[model samples]
Target: MPRAKDLDTVAPDDFLNSTLKSPLPPRPIKKPQNKKIKHLHQSSNGKSHSAQFRQNVYGILGKTKHPFSSFLVKPKVFNFRERDTDEEIILVLRRHWITNLTWILITLSMIIAPILLTTVPLLESFPPAYQFISIIFWYLITFIYSFEQLLSWYFNVYIITDERVIDIDFNNLLSKNFSEAKISMIQDVTSTIIGVSQTFFNFGNIQIQTAAEVPEITFEKVPNPEIIIKVLGQLRQEEELENIEGRVK
Candidate 1:
């Protein structure tokens, strides 16, 4: 805008002629094309970084999935009998799969026991019917033992949820022992990987000391004991923080 002194210096006729003409068409702004291209590239790079970060997070969350896995994290299709609706399971574990080797070896031996025994004259002294019945009985016993062990290994599970720690054990087909302790009650966690096999397989036992009815709960031969301990520690911290917040209110 012209200042008062500059306007006073201009001729009235010139000022009138300038205002009277159709206002010059406003000049179109010239955008810097290179700056726009650079801005677009930066935005694309940010989006890619954000997408990669989300993918990594999902990979961490869905770390385990195999149904027979001894150690699982954030399982998608598992639920327990006594679990609360709001409680979320963070970890599900059983004895390391390698622990089943003892029974597996024994079962394999039992399967071939009859063949090995054929080299002996033990059945020669008996009648044909007696020998048949005896062999049948031996195999029956072996089958029963194998079945029982399979059930035991499959059913005995230790679970860690956002709210509690649970141990489920089946001593027999008809009997199950269920033990649980709140995350808030857990005081200390101790892990032991004693023998060569345990160390080699990276599996061990973990003892949890809690203020719940069961003072100490032990998970025998579970995989990733240190990771379990770390998760428990995190849960305990969260529980304590929640308690403090509750008390403040």
Candidate 2:
């Protein structure tokens, strides 16, 4: 070996020439991935939107998904008389359309039975006076069946407001059941979707446990019970925040 100093030290010109001849590798060019990400985000958002209101509970009444608008006795204004000025109706829910099938079948049978009876030999044997009376009785029964079933369905509703949740049940022409609980009083929520029809139609029941007088409130056969549970949770969180900020209304 020559001098150690000579071996260890290279000329500045040689080092400069080596770097100039062999340049450092270029950094990998990144392709634009924004389009792919944007497309995915949009599709996810669309799916969520469509799933939220997939089926309308008021299909018999109208095309409207909203219960308030579908009602024949809908108010011109949103604010119902007894509700506070600040209270707003977040949602008005009715039992799923599947639940009304029983009443609908009964009404249809009541309507068709009269026509079927007329063709029977037993009705033909009756006197004119008796036949007329029979026809009147048949029609009266039909009317009552139709009226009662329709009235019960139309009046029975679950109202969720900013302040509370109300369950209005119409038992008959003269009797009704009403239950309500404040939003803040709600403690837990459970949703159940049992039966093939319920699973297929995406309708279910929501059971809410509360700290109020009524410990538990069940919303039976309601459409989109999972979404309702999510909404109740969000509403409770909001109510809690409002209370903390002293903005309770």
Clashing residue pairs in all predictions, respectively, total 0, 0
Clashing pairs in 2: none
Q: How many clashes would you count in candidate 1?
A: 0
- Per-model C-alpha RMSD: 11.5, 15.6
Over 4 Å off in model 1, which ranges?
1-62, 247-249
Question: Would you list the C-alpha lDDT of every candidate in the order shown?
Answer: 0.82, 0.72
Model 2, residue 235: distance off in Å is 0.5
lDDT of 1 by residue, 1-249 (tens): 754547668877778887988587889999767988887876676556545533443354458858788887777887889988877788889999998999999999999998888778876888989888988999999999999999899889998887789999889988899999988889889999998999999999899999999999999999988778777776666566556544211
TM-score of 2: 0.68
The lDDT, on a scale of 0 to 1, for candidate 2 is: 0.72
